[model samples]
Target: MAANGKSRNLESFVKQQLEGAQKRFGDLEQEAGKVFRTLKARSKGQAREVEKLLGQINSDALLENPKVKEFGRKATQVSTDLRKRLDGLQTKAVEAVGVASQAQVKELNRELSRLSKKLDQLLPASVKKVTSRGSRVSAS
Candidate 1:
């Protein structure tokens, strides 16, 4: 009875450790997803703003203010260029901070997943066939 209880306690401890590890992995995955979403949303919002402004400049009503339209166009171009440069700088900054960008993280995760699947597929064949018989084991 004592041995059985000890075994059960050990099993539960192992189970708890596994659960904790799984939870941490899930949290990291979620954080990576959030980072990707944040980067994507910022870029998309900048693009949408530029597009909306450009569209307004092209509208028929804005023709009376040609100077205003020209300035708006210039502003849009400047904004687009600035956003690109800013994004580039931001990526470099993130690299400098020793944290992989969301894109790199995602790619690494994808490659890891692919390799894991491949490993799983090959694992069975890679394993040595252990014979229960002493004679067969001794022959190896």
Candidate 2:
């Protein structure tokens, strides 16, 4: 009789836990739905804005000028050539100094960050990568 009572209590406890979990999951589902709806609305608004911007862009008659286009093409080529020369100079500087340049350091840091995120996924959740710099944001 005692054993039966214990088994009955255990079964009731399990049922209660299951019900609680189901309720929590239902709440989570509702929250997720709300978030999805919010994001969907925001995305739709952005899409409309982008569409209007593109329409305005298409309506611009100045872009159709051949002379304007030729000038743009030449400007682009000059900029590209100048960029190549500058990059060559930068590389020569880095070689002469026998050290990584700021640009190189930033690129390496970015690659390290990407790899660290991937590595973190494979490792335990308790582990996190640390950053030396404080939070600093740059304008585009």
Candidate 3:
């Protein structure tokens, strides 16, 4: 009976632990989402700024000089390459966030499963203890 009571207590404890873990996972997921959104906005703004700079340079007197023209072309190409790299990085960041989110979820599930199994091992003895005592007590 004492063992049975112990099992119930352990079960209740495990349930609380699982709930806490789930809440933590939710908070982490929300934070990750916010970070992803911020990165996306910043990338877009940066791309726009680069485009504006390139446009201004192209319209300037430097474009009329042969030597300057070559330099300007090279600069534009570099800018384009940088923009492409940024885009690739942004895509990778998104993918990383997704993978991290999945990993977190999996971690939470594994924790819950482990706690549940531990509770299962302890519950029978707790129930037996409670029954033998012949009195009801709050699990909390």
Candidate 4:
């Protein structure tokens, strides 16, 4: 009897914990999506600005001027560096989300293991009670 009660309680606890984990995972996934979208939009805007600068250089009458060429080169390098940084940040964000997901899974497993142990400890007494009660009822 005690074993049955303990098993039921453990089952309930496991279910509750899993539900909470699912909620947390969902939230993290949504947040990651948001971060990706934000980064993409920012990258697109920067790319557009770089394109416009290049187009301006092409239109300028001083396109052959040394200073103008140097400025254009510097602008290109800056844009390239910005792109690399953004790419790094995006990669890091993805890795962080993955780590978070793994951690949540580990936590859920630990909780489940603890609950199972507790149920195991309670089971013998529960069975004994149920068997005794059944015998008494039959005798009566």
Best-fitting candidate, scored by TM-score: 4
Please provide, for model 4 over 1-140, each residue's C-alpha lDDT reduced to its tens digit, 9 standing for 90 to 100.
Answer: 66667668877976786677577668877987998899999999999998888787755567878998999899999999999998997667646544335676699789878976786675555333335445522222
User: What TM-score does candidate 1 reach?
Assistant: 0.32
Q: Please, what are the lDDT tens digits per residue for candidate 1 over residues 11-100?
A: 697578657656665676687789989999999999999898878775666666889789989999999999999799766755554555
Task: Give the range where candidate 2 is weakest over 10 consecutive residues by summed lDDT.
Answer: 122-131
Question: How well is each residue in 1-140 modelled by candidate 2, as lDDT tens digits?
Answer: 34436547866975786576566656666876898899999999999998888787754575787887998899999999999997997567445544555787699679767865675566543333334674434333
Off by over 4 Å in 3: 50-140
**If scored against the real structure, what TM-score would every candidate get?**
0.32, 0.37, 0.38, 0.40
Q: What is the C-alpha RMSD of each candidate to the true structure, in Å?
A: 12.2, 24.1, 10.5, 9.3
For this target, which candidate reaches the highest lDDT against the unseen true structure?
4
Ranking by TM-score: 4, 3, 2, 1
Distance from true position, residue 82, model 4, in Å? 14
For residues 17-134, what per-residue lDDT tens digits would candidate 3 score against the true structure? 6676577657766887998899999999999998888787855675688997898789999999999997997567555434334676699679868876775676654442344566
Candidate 2: where are CA atoms >4 Å away? 54-140
Candidate 4: the clashing residue pairs are 1-126, 1-127, 2-126, 3-123, 3-126
- Comparing 2 with 3 on lDDT, the higher-scoring candidate is 3
Backbone clash pairs for candidate 2 read none
Query: How many residue pairs in model 4 have overlapping backbones?
Result: 5
Candidate 4 deviant stretches above 4 angstroms = 51-140
